[model samples]
Target: MVEKNTTKTYIKEWQKAIQKEISFLKKFGGTRYIVYNGRFISRDEMFTYYFDTSSSLPIPIGSKIRLEWGGLKTNGRVLSSEGKGMIVALEKSIGELISEATLLHDPWELLENLIERLDEIKKSKQKRARLKRLMDPTMEPKHPTTRIKSNVHELTLRSKYNPVTFVWGPPGTGKTYTLARVAANKYLQEKRILVLAHSNQAVDVLLAEISLFLKRKDKFCVGDVLRYGTNSGQSLANHTEITSEQLIESSNPKLSKERTALLVERRTIKQDLTRSFSKRDSDELLEIETKLARLLDKFRQKELELLKKAAIIGTTLAKAASDSAIYEKEFDLIIVDEASMAYVPQAAFAATLGKRVIICGDFKQLPPIAASRDLLVTEWLKEDIFHKTNVADSVNQQKLHPHMLLLKEQRRMHPDISAFTNQYIYKSLVADHEAVYTNRNKIVLQTPFSGHASILLDTSYTGHHSLSEKSSNSRYNLWQLLLSFQLIYESVLGGAKSIGYVTPYRIQSNLMNLLIEELLENENKNADIIAATVHRFQGSERDVMIFDTVDAEPQSRPGMLLVGKDSERLINVAITRTRGKFIHVSNTSFIKKNIFRGKTLRQLVDHQMQHNQQVTTQKIGYWIKNQHSKLAWSHARKQSKVFQDLQSAKNSIVIAIPEGKTLATEWERMLAKRHPKVSFTLVSKQPMQHLQPNQWMDENIAFPFILIDEEILWLGQPLEAVVDVDPPFVAARLHSRKVSEFFIGQLLKE
Candidate 1:
């Protein structure tokens, strides 16, 4: 029997973690908005609230929102987004309170479910033992384990004997593909299975794979698999027949007819209420709302019945936990794909609903994006199942767990590209599948820098300075953005089919998106390209991956991209996402200075340098200039060229520096003395004591750059470099009025 004290400690820890999450949400205003106007729609049987569109975060369609007005609050789920309005299905009618309502974060219903599940575990001996085994990695399984097998799929199939099994999959290891096969096999055995993932996209992807597998085996039926949520991927539209809502409507004509009739009545009543809000109309509206609620309850009952009969069910973790009907239902087996992105509590909650649980994910990838930094919360909530159970430690230490299976063969990246991750991240545990070395997967970009599978574009000569936004913690680097665009543009021209631009910051990703759009517009080329953060790029691969490390400010330490507990994992994901070529765009000088904090990044750079895979700024500039002479050029060795370019400015000059106000003041004086008529504005993050407010703007600029005459854009080496002895600085010049105007607008934004 488990000790009572230990169980109590677990309960307390879970409670503290949940509270910390709630506290953080309250403090940071997690997905909230205040309604300016609201009204009940009888036709749709839902409430519509119009709010300002200037929210810090967008409220997703399926998010549960809490409405508060006049000291009363009610809960509802967002049905859809309509213009500047949100359509929500509230639990109860607020009548006139709708207009004065404030939409708050989702209700803490999941927290209650988690706590209740903990209490149930505390009361049941079987549950306690299962939880103990899942949480305590040292606890040996009561059942004898099967012998290790070379085939990971076969090993996963045999995992039914163990109470819990972990699939330690690294990048490109086909983690979801393996999980789908195991789930399909279990379904064939007549065992009801629950498939869960961290995101709706992941859940849909896995369900689609399982559907295909079952169809290939000739055991698939119309109602064999059911997708439980509404936010399904467009690709899953092919299997719309398997959705719970669709299945219920088709199978049971009586309930479907009733729902249709209720919806029609609701529409009629809503039309009447729109004309008048009299007491009688309000009463009629409330009556219709009651009828619709009863109808929805019936639909839920039917859905539960359908869920019990289905061979497999797929939904996100949040959906599975928040929905009471799904939470009450149990399954014979539960498989969580992308389990590393799920919190420990979420995985544990999934564990309670199944007789056996299998978690498939790479713990070396991203973890749950938690807002709280409380030690207890980070220890209990931020950690995924692998870390919580010490499985990650065992895998890293080369100690194999009896119930854990590791998929070492990866079919995604080329041997040359995978070598770095294999040595530095995985400790040589991962191997390339034979198919990866074939001619089909060879790196063959048509660009000059295409021979090697990997290239580290060292931006040290250009001084890769990054800026943090004043409103948010996101950072952006202009030089990296421009260089990445050139590389991507050249690769697209070289016949690259697919490309993925991965960055560590949202601002930088946004900049990349703009550049890609321009490339498509100007070049009129058709190519598959996606720019996003590393978290969004997980579970995806591409022909050429551009990993932009957008943190290189000299004054500040490396950002979370290179100085967090998960830094190595982030780097590993970024590097391993490439199938043919991997480009690491970073400032080597900044990384070397902060080597202790950014050890993983420094190690990656060192590996590339040792292999002579370093691409210089001069080469990039020369290549771009050769392709489009008027577009861009680099001047690394000559400070005279930068000043010479600056001297050509006739209209205005805006110099933005993060620090060094003294140096900036001297440079501004010299520039103003030289060009007396040109407007000179020195922008810095701190107030300049020597300049007027009009001449100096206090803003949180990340890097130093000079916008000359709103036509010539000078990036690299602050204006201070002109006066002081020039270090190994590289300045880039872009002659694009559109690009210059875009930067000027961003810098001058209120």
Candidate 2:
């Protein structure tokens, strides 16, 4: 095939030519001299030692000169017009220029290689037809796995193919765990894999997960795994098997030898330059310049060698793109974790380095952040391989190209906690058996008021807003800050293993950090805790979480930056981050009035109320007396429902109403002779004793309305004793057939 001489064909060549210019000028122009007399001179030195009175110079005196020595660049003016040579001033000396020039070799050679590969693919008809075949629906095959979860099995089989495969991972659906296992399985087959992500933290997370899986279950020694990236900090530093950049730099024999020799040479040059200045010898300067050039070339060669030997490499896209050492390298497969959070161009660039690609991420959690609003609307910029390929209603329903597997089983969140996201985002998501039963014991440990698993604190007050003119961080609300501290203290007292404070805005995060620091400084609790902005805590989770909804007022809006885009993603992330408990702090009235009609927090609160286990007890008084809603039991619809529950009782029922409570008088006046077969006992208060086996209640029970019988336990606060005002809070209809038998059994024993 003939190559066209367009920008696409010669872009890399242009880049190389520019880099060569920077290199040649740095070596040729980077020179410093010491005057015979005692004078310190640096930067843009004259071409001649003295001006020639006979020959006129081509350029005028006092002209501005810009000089770049390797990486060291600066501009200055000619200082003086001497007889044959003019003195020029500079900011940096020869030592600094030499140090910077040594690093002038372009590090973006890998990116250039990827661009060239893309150009080749675009220009070649055979490669394009092969890619088209890989994406063809007729060519796609159905392969099964021995693993029980169909999603993991499908992903493993698809990893062998040459086309791009997407694993649509909604929140809590074990994306990292699934991909790590697949990569490990491939490694056992001796296929080289490259794991990538947008951030170092994400890459480290995948590395940690991979190490844990290999050590804990597979029992496979992970000696071949290598982490190659700019980020030196690895969370799994103790696991010596996982090699990091720091380890390679410090331990590689060739790199160590050359770097050590270079350092020694640099020190000797500094000493020689000082001696020459005293002896009035200018020839040492040339010797130092020649030595610097040789040492730099040797250092770069060693760096290239270390990268070529790495079999299975893990790195962020930015590091992989810039590292020149890995330019010519290719992998059998590249697994991109958190692919949805990366810009399309970045993920595409990483894809060019490998033959087969596997992208695992949830577009429902968060999309790539675009700086300009216009870019968000641009069709091509918004596309991620994972999301773009997933066009079918469900993974199983697909009949055509772009193979995908949807991971529907969530194992991270409690059933009660996962219901929100399951409803709003992942309609097909179901909780695994372990996830459903894991939090059962944890629920009993929490006090009733602390929100057994989830709670929503809805306030009507306009929270404090202090906007800084210089930043985009949302202002902190004083009320929300106090509530976060209160919950943190409560969680600590409740024996929470760890706590995390999630705020949508930076200002709230900053304020919450102060409160957490105060708690630590006072030595109040030794609980493990951390507070961070929501964007920073994407790949993390904790035992219990407190999300501070910073936008409290109706007019201020919920999140400043999350207005038009689907804020449901932000909510899903916050809700699914906790395995034990989640508390949402926001203004209820504002959310109801101005937001998505209270669909976010209100839905969670309603879910919690629906899942709360009902405690059966005959005594009730405290709620009627303490709660002051005059029309509490006045809702006609609520009253009708309560009577319907009472009428359904097969045997005797107990009704406890505090004195002067209007609902009790109304019940007495209304239902004295309605049902003769069912016995009715009305009492002002019930004694503090075991009313049934494992059932007890104090005389001042706070619930305004209560009806406990052989079969049902109904407790609620009426809106107006009429039509439903707040359907979720108005009444709770709970009934278990065993409750009636258990009540009779207890009575017979008594």
Candidate 3:
């Protein structure tokens, strides 16, 4: 056979290819064929009743024909040959079919059509067999572990090494509510279940939900399932309450105030750090930078240890049938909440804790640690593992594997919010079923609000904005982040009018402490809050949230940029918790630096007015300049539309930063001293508890000078950071000045 380029071949060429394949199959002995509504369907695919042992047949390969019967009409083609050299075909739908096929094939064309239809019938039979297996009664509602909801067609979400069935519901979608029902149903089937979550705050909510459904049974454990990432780990009950006292007890309770005092003393080191690198002061600057770095590192370790010691590590447990002592105390099934932000290895290991597992997480919220070299979602989906007999490579293959499902119906968030994410963010699992998902998930592009959520462009007012680089021993962006955090806090969360604040970065966490002190001294309002990484916020819901998608990467980075994967998970948690409103802030370039910055996100919705007008490069440029819009217009649709190219933006930003240059890719302190007043705010869910959130709320913070971030933009900073190495801190150009002013205010508060 001569082989040539077929890429540009029309559908008719594909038809001939099928005809040739069918002819070859005819030479061999063919199996009996079955007809469904006069259309060729395979006997193997014919269904008597659904069962665990049932199998499905394949559809016909390729031969175009239309069938009408039983008030149903469908366009189908001979897909392929099946069963002992017999040919078959499955119907390929082009558009929605509301009417049924009622007409019959003419008798004159009957035998001719029938013989040809044999192949089509054979393919249908194959497809039917597979569909039967999918609908197998035992595999459907009456399964050993699940309650079958007759009205819905279930798509089970699972993975090979990880047996967990993961589900994710947005805000107002009742993630906990759905979880409780699923857990209860599974538990009723005589399975020992473990319900785990990452956030200390989220643990509280889950425990409460379980308490309502089932009184704590000896066979069950639910609560703050502590995932001890540290080397020093321990075990405890699932729903153990953690308090400040526990932290003190974990360490020497006697050292409580002593540790706090040491942390306090480090604040004075800031003065020495502000100096520049000069021949006369270079030695002194180096000495001060070294001391500050050590102090910062030390404080972070001790503080984290304190938190780990306070959190509850699940029961003294192991899985069933495994008597390895460690695996001896086993759970029948395992369930993890707030899994999006979890490290892949930690989550995978946790999933294996039970004979069966269910994981619930939103990929859009956060992603796995890109730097961690471990088995993760993408890896698990792509790798092969031991089956009953052989290993299976793909989870989503034609043959059923008793694992893997995708839950696409999400109703917790306002349809708009969910739609935006599904459109501009993650798209793998969102469904299109009208019965299951009534709302069409329409989106209003470029809509920005102040109270709940909003998007803003580069807005500027009259001000002396300096782009300065911060001084640091390492080419990190700690200072830059610090300044940005303050500006965001005051402008968005609540200036002096608000009570709490949260920061995921350790450096910012430390700086927040310093700012709070000064505020309290000056008699500022104190609001308590939960602040940390997306991992910290996982499972825990909050009211009034703010997210900063601030990355220092230029226009060519991969994956998520300003927001770390774990941080993105946290940001997801933050946005979902806003019962009332949520706020999001990022460099005007965030979308450009991330996913929305690409061409794929842009769908051409042509100009509405007709003028026989054609859009040219020059016209497009004119359009962009006049509207200050980022996307191009297309000629397909009548209405003009803007595209959100998030993935492309992320890739571009990653590309802009040179590799191994920490300061270039990540935020730097010097940049923190640059801009002074570029800021924005968004709203989030209401607080779960009435008491104000965050300790920083009570700080007496203030500032006197206009701090600039331009101190280190062109310093001896590294260019591109290592792809897998820790990102150096990149300063928020505007925040340096704001943070400095806020620090002064905090100091004077007393």
Candidate 4:
């Protein structure tokens, strides 16, 4: 459950913040008003104004506007424009303003009051009936597991029945694809569905996939699909389907002239609707409402038809909340794609229009752009419904609700790269066998030197930050920049069609772009190389990915490395973007100190080092423990044979002990007593000599072994006494017979 505030302190601060914002906006206005058509509008502060059907200025509705009149400069947002006039909201703040739908204003009281109402409803008789219907245990998943994975089937089925079903879609697991499939399938069953995403681009992606799926199956015609909003035409321009814009174009032929006149009329249609709604004249309201309905019926029939046809409705969550046509409409199911990136209130508001809700996104990936950390009074603002509902404590304590699902099969990234993330992040992430056994996951790097698919280029630069003189947000390292160029050159020479360069800092990315631009200008050449920040390149991938970790200098500000999950998510996205090769460039010394940012790089370094021949005591101990169970039988047989030889020896067995060491322990004496013919010899380095007496023949040779009856040579770390120990205590595996024989031959020569 959520914590609620008992006092009005938070409410006051929230109100103060809003007032401060309005004050800040007022500062953007000047003391001048622009006159158009003998009418005056205040321009005292910067306000945005959009013209209606006029060829004055082609300022886009959403573009940031700065007004300059009478040597006074101010800024604001364009509220509305029509009939050779424009309505401008003075003193607009470009910064993220807390949307009215958000619960930041007295959230605690709102939530608490909501909970109290819910509790009262729970005690009512009608509530009991509703709960009984919802809690039907006989309800099972509708889809067959044979056709789809059980988990996915359960998710699709629960999402259809439950009011809200949260889906934990990790990276590369086809969150969009799965949801689209479900949407398409549900559509065929005559269920009206609305699919929403955080961005218009995300909506387009879902529409494209759903359209493709339905088309492939011959389930629905392409004309049944509809897209909405500004530039809806361009976004769906490639598709041979019906859209809202197309509907508007297809009007009654008898009124064609009237329609044309209406299109070019110097009046604003938006303002007409606003004025009509605001007026209290019943007859006028009826007339205006009837006209709007008729107009919308003529133009929005295809969109209306698509919604009725149960084909699919695609829109951004924000659009779904704001659009008058959809705000009042109810749907059988609402699927939210990339739900983790949407504000909780926005999604909740969208869910209100639907009977069932399905939220799909990975909380571990990039979330919504948080405007201000201070304004976000609760963590709920930053998380989607999926994350907020699935608390770790509830799951750990076995008190989890069973409606959620996780997509575990990662279809992207090489096994090497995916393996790191799987171990580092996922609870149970399985790499597809295709990525392991097939060549698809193998990265193709064409560097001059043969290196691993994932390679770390050590710049050796430490704690030096170079802030850009041109851009304030960027930082770059000369060493890293030079390395990036070399790698890019190599990649281009190696016949790579495209290469993506990503830097953690905007400054470094800017510097890299500048370098690329200058190089292109000088050489008069163009290449398919795109440089972007990690956040910008979220949904994109490249043939070869070159990531520049730009924070080689001491971090004065709390950077990606320090932020809890943001760093992990960013690094994961950066490294996994490469399809063929993942090239990481960073300073090792600087990165080792970071907990999250350089984790992938450090893992790669450790992996590379393991392949080298240099051995350590820990490495030796690990080897011995692993091989003990397999080679124990053979070693035991060898020991038995050595004991028999000592027992049967007629001559004394001369055993050499190293200097300053002894075999006078009880176990050693017992072994000596068992074999009375064995004798011990001390191998010592003589005074003023650099070599031991035993190694006088060869100064390069040193033996740390024990000889029994002068026949058996046990090659390992020698202890003070000869006693059998476990494998961990043993320093090395037994040496080869050839090496032992060569040593013995050298001893005889000495």
Candidate 5:
């Protein structure tokens, strides 16, 4: 019997999650759009609308939408989207009220379908029993009769009794490759398989692998493997043959011809109906409309037949539950890749569609993206199936689980590079593959990291602070930006080919992109380098990985990248993406002081300090002087220090403040009295009352900075009150005469 309490709880939690998502979507200004035009396509029984393409949230094809205009709202589904426009199939038409409407992304259909499926499972005894087994945390797994082997793939292929199997795949463990092999093995046995993942990209990847493996085995056939849902651009470019559209078009000529003929007939009927309506021929119009409806139904029936015939089908979890035809089908085995990123309800719904389920993912990586902070929403919606099943807990406690297999051999990173994650994050559960050791000597480093496998580029002594961006929550550090760019520049100069710059903020990534572009343009050099957040660099690797922890300063606590529950996983991913060397740039002292809950980052700093070469400001300064621009910059904590340094100025001092901000009266008076002979010029968006017209100029500045005697430059927000009151607010001081004079010339030119 299905437990009423459990069923109700599942429904309640899923509803709460849906509400949370809707609230988040509205709060973020992602759902509302101003419609430019709307028209009805009577033949296809759909409506097309055009709107601005600039949306904060991406609206992929096949997403459900709702149109609100003229005191009316109708639900619809996005049929196609191109530049600045989209076609949608709405439930009903609002006649002649298409002038200026609102479009909202409605995800309720998918969530409601999931909840209905859960309810269906609750009503079925067999499904309820299966769910109990899958979710039971206290159930002990059957022990293996033979000695465990090192190859997890072999073990998984040999097992046949478990109804639910979990694969603990860490980074570089060939998880997707293993899933493809298993699917291939099942196909050879003539068992139907359904492959699902949390994202469309993951689905495409696995389907491509399956197609390749089947072809290698000489068992491949047209329409044997199918990619469902909208085809991604990358997949189409790489493996178009696996898409359902391509397969159907290539294999079935009769259906293609019939579809074309039906489309032509429908168009003719639509044209005829328009004329019939103008002539007041109601009977003729009704007959033409009836013919169009029949044709559309026939077309849909043929398409559904082609979709359901594939022996191996692949799609995302959301699509699997949302598409009615797909959700109704049954398979012998359901394999979920990246299961740890799947929502609990979505994963559970997938589990009910097959006789046996195989889940592959690493809980150590990112989970489902949940924006709600409510405790229940997070507990139900954000948690993955691995955590719900107690599989992760079992592996963590004993390094092994009977029902789950852990892939321990890593083929991505060198031993030196992987050791950090192996010891601290994975608790020595992972080891390097034999090939890594055999080919370890083949890897070589460049100039800055010539003889080192890892280095800690500590910026604590530089007095550089990470400042919050005015427009967003993201932060950026000027010192780390220059330091990271220099490392990349010098590394490229020394023949480094592939590099990955992983940071925690978008603002820092954007700045790095600009700097890298400038470097590439000036030097006329090319390299395979990417600057992105760790989330974007999850499944990618490079020859050299530069991880910049952008959070520093005492006033700002550790960012979510360092102190959250997934901080360890974030760090693990960052350090393990390198094949040759790893460079961590940050203020170690600040991290050490602020990070209280997580030990992964703390242990990482200590490990690097103990085992690797340390790069200090002295070495960085020397490198900058010799290789790149010859400028020396230092950090100061207070604006008062800039005033003290002004005592030595002889010629001119320029203080530029941002709009609506002014120089502190006390600092202005002190600087004037202390440096009487120094020419002081204040640049502001408006004329200041405290200064003479000759001493003040009306000009806009992005941030507050001071230039002293055309030789020393102070870069930071000096005019803000927080700079003086907060100890962590830092400003950079550069003592390069040429660089200072360049700035002075630019300011004085206008």
Candidate 6:
């Protein structure tokens, strides 16, 4: 007898229904799907039911499930008969299971029963819909599985619109671990599931998940399969790193890039409805795209001259395949993680390879390409020409199919910090679970805090001869400032704090070498100093954050950081890196040296200058954390100290420093010595003139070319601090880097 419950489906039309006679695999290959109310799954409900290594039954797809504390497993449809067939097929024989089986009243039996009932209903509907929509465009997916929530009476509010779902679980939210069963259900049912991640470490974690899931499938471990986008993604491989240029290119060549392009085209058109791409300079880019589209038509028709003439547009979508006729490789699903910092074009370029996609991200963290003055914008042509004039239609943009949804609940930072972030960050979110205010589910990343943080404008120097001189000459006087802060914090703490050094480019990596060598590598000083790209820290757990905006371009604020757009799923990954304590160090001391030339950063710097002019010192307060960076922002401004989050931030702090003189000095020295033999020639072909600060170049400055071994070096003073333009042959123009003694000879004032 079916237990009568109030649970029912809300959006009558189920985009994906469970398949008949097939065991649910991963998101890609589940035999079928079941539709039910999803709104019932609260932010806290998805994890109420827990399946461990010991649970004889793996979490099935489209199953009515729930998890509760204590060993009392309360479930509805315990999957007694159909599950038997799946287990017999994937793991063991039906004979062995029946012979040894003694069905007990396991509390989870209820959940299994409920799932069967739901599956049975789905099966009946499938039988009808399959025949009704034989060639129907609306019923296109062969077998799409609706997301299942383990809490509440139903799992309704699932996302299937773009066929790509994104869940940004911060720190200990089990981001990687939770996908195990979800992935397995899709695979068992039969689907090609691709895991797209930015780093090898993340892929490794997912590999561990696959192993654990298979180990429990006593019967079906044979057909269980998994694959990564890279060699380092293999759980057992020990391969070396591939060059960044090579790694990003030809990655699954036709497959991945095609999928990304499709996603890019769709998302751009969708967003264009609300925001004007022209206002963002993306509209003018269309003029270039139209010319290329016509050229492409000529090229596709075997016109060689068109190819030579279309270099400009091809630069935007290098091999971007917009036509569906060329891209037909269909997949069950594509899962993308860490997407925020991803440039929009790169993400869209990779989506054409997948049939289905899921995206996840947190926008409030750090955005893509470091917060600079203004932002970069790019959009592709909409196959449909009718919507060109009135592209800002909100209805079309909001028409995210039932499955294409956003997740709002944030399980990463502490409530103390999340409040400050959400309040300051996502004023408007796209999903229900995108932001939650509680500490019940997050990891315990609590660090002690007492108001001791303060920014010290240090004035010292410690580096090699050339680097040391540059450090001394820097506008910020960073080395001397760093030493001063180190001395003060060392005296009180007696050891180094958990400090991190972040630079926008590899050139910045040189500066951290000395500090890291003296402490971490040498192990001479008792402290912790980590050097990493800001990209790697996304979705990580950290106590203190110190931003080195010293030479960084200025900016206003960021809305999101898209690192990758898997398939059609927009998974923003970078901006959600820090748990507490954010510090920014920019070369604001001399506004002219600021690398970024945009509206956002100018506003920030100008506002701060205005702020300092109004606020007096005696009323000011301060806080401290690591030995590097300035006095925490909480103490520098009275208005900021009122936040309750700051009350718990004694141990966590934000250090802000506008650029100064000394920091640049040491960096220049380091740059000159790194290429002691490098030489540069004037791009204008003019005789050497006075090398003054403002008159170093004429119009469209260019320089000589040389290599610093295999390492690619980006020069400063004009192209950086928020403006990202790194083309190998072109960078030499304004930002030159050559391995020759000629240029260094002239640059060396000594």
Please estimate how well model 2 matches the true structure, expressed as its whole-model Cα lDDT. 0.54
- Tens-place lDDT per residue, model 1, 1-750, is 867336556766887788887777665545557665465654355554333223323566566777777776677776544234345677766774355567787446566666677776677776666676677746455544465444544545545667788888898787767888888878878888999988888898889888888788888898889999764557587777778888888988898998788667656655554454444644554565567677777888888888777889999888887777677777889998889998787887788778889888888888887777899778877778888777877766777676678888988887878888888888888888898787534464445365667889877755535766546768878878878887787777767778889998888898778766654565435568989988888887788889999777544688866777788888888998888888899887778877763378888988899898887765654445234443454554455666776677676878776655345444555474546677777788677655442377777565577788887777764545332223445566766666677677777777
Candidate number with the higher TM-score (2 or 5): 5
lDDT of 4 by residue, 1-750 (tens): 433321122233333433433333344422223423211223445532322323233333333344443344444444433334344444643222211110011112222332333343334554333223222212343434455555546777767656556677666777777887888878877877888887777787778778778778877664456666543344465653545554445534544455455444324444453344222322232333345446655655545554555347787765665555665576878887877777554555555556777777776666665333445433645555555444322434434445556677776665655666676655344454375434533245354223345656654422133333232435555436645765676666555666788877766676567656644343224347888788777766676788777655434433543244566677777876766677777655555665344455455445434534222222322222122210121232234444454466444343444434344343243345444434543343422132112233222212334444344444332434223233333322222333334334444553
- Model 4, backbone clash pairs (residues 3+ apart or across chains), number: 17
TM-score, per-candidate, Cα-based: 0.80, 0.59, 0.39, 0.59, 0.74, 0.38
| Number of the predicted model whose TM-score against the real structure is largest | 1
The residue pairs that clash in candidate 5, if any, are none
Query: Per-residue lDDT for 1-750 in model 3, tens only?
Result: 433222112112323433333343333212322342122222233211100101223322233334433444443333222221212222532222212222111111212332232233234443223222221212322233355452112312132123334454444445665665555555555445565554434444554455455544543333222222211112214323222233333555545555455434433322222232122332332343345455545545654554333222222111111113222335666666666555332344444455655555555564433221223323422121111112122322433234433355554444323444444333434532333133212211111223222222120110112121232211112323333334334333332222223333443444545544433334333433444444445444443344433333322332232333333334445455432223443333323434442332111001101212222222222222211011112332111110121111211110112222223211333223223332111011222122212211222111111122211111111223222222221112121333454433332343
TM-score for predicted model 3 compared with the true structure: 0.39
lDDT of 4 at 404: 56
Candidate 5 lDDT, 522-620, residue by residue in tens? 553556888998888776678788999987763458887777778877888888888777889978788778776347887888888777556666565
After best superposition, candidate 4 residue 506: deviation in angstroms? Answer: 1.6
Q: Give candidate 3's total backbone clashes.
A: 181
Q: Which portions of model 1 show Cα errors greater than 4 Å?
A: 1-5, 32-49, 52-83, 87-107, 137-153, 249-299, 439-443, 446-448, 517-525, 621-631, 634-704, 708-712, 716-750
User: For residues 1-750, what per-residue lDDT tens digits would candidate 6 score against the true structure?
Assistant: 543211123011111121110122221232222211111111122221111111234334234432222233223322211111111111111121111221122222222332333333344443223222211123333233554454110111122233334344333445555555555555655655555544455555565565566567752342233332223444434221121222223333554454456445534542442243222322322333444455435334432222222211001111122222212333455554544444332233234345554443333344443111221111111111111112112224533233223344556544443433343234333222334334322222222123212121211111111121232233222322243233334322533344444433333344444434433343435445555555555545443444443332222222122112220111112223444333333334333343243333333344334433211122222223442222222211222222222232222111111122112343233333332233322222232233112112221222222122212222222222212222221111111122222233323444
- Give the higher-TM-score candidate: 4 or 5: 5
lDDT to native, each model? 0.73, 0.54, 0.33, 0.51, 0.70, 0.31
After superposition, the stretches of candidate 4 with alpha carbons farther than 4 Å from their true spots are 1-75, 79-152, 230-238, 246-310, 391-401, 433-451, 461-465, 468-474, 521-528, 554-558, 561-565, 593-750
lDDT of 3 at 531: 40
**Residue-level lDDT for 429 in candidate 1:** 85
The weakest ten consecutive residues by lDDT in model 6 span: 380-389
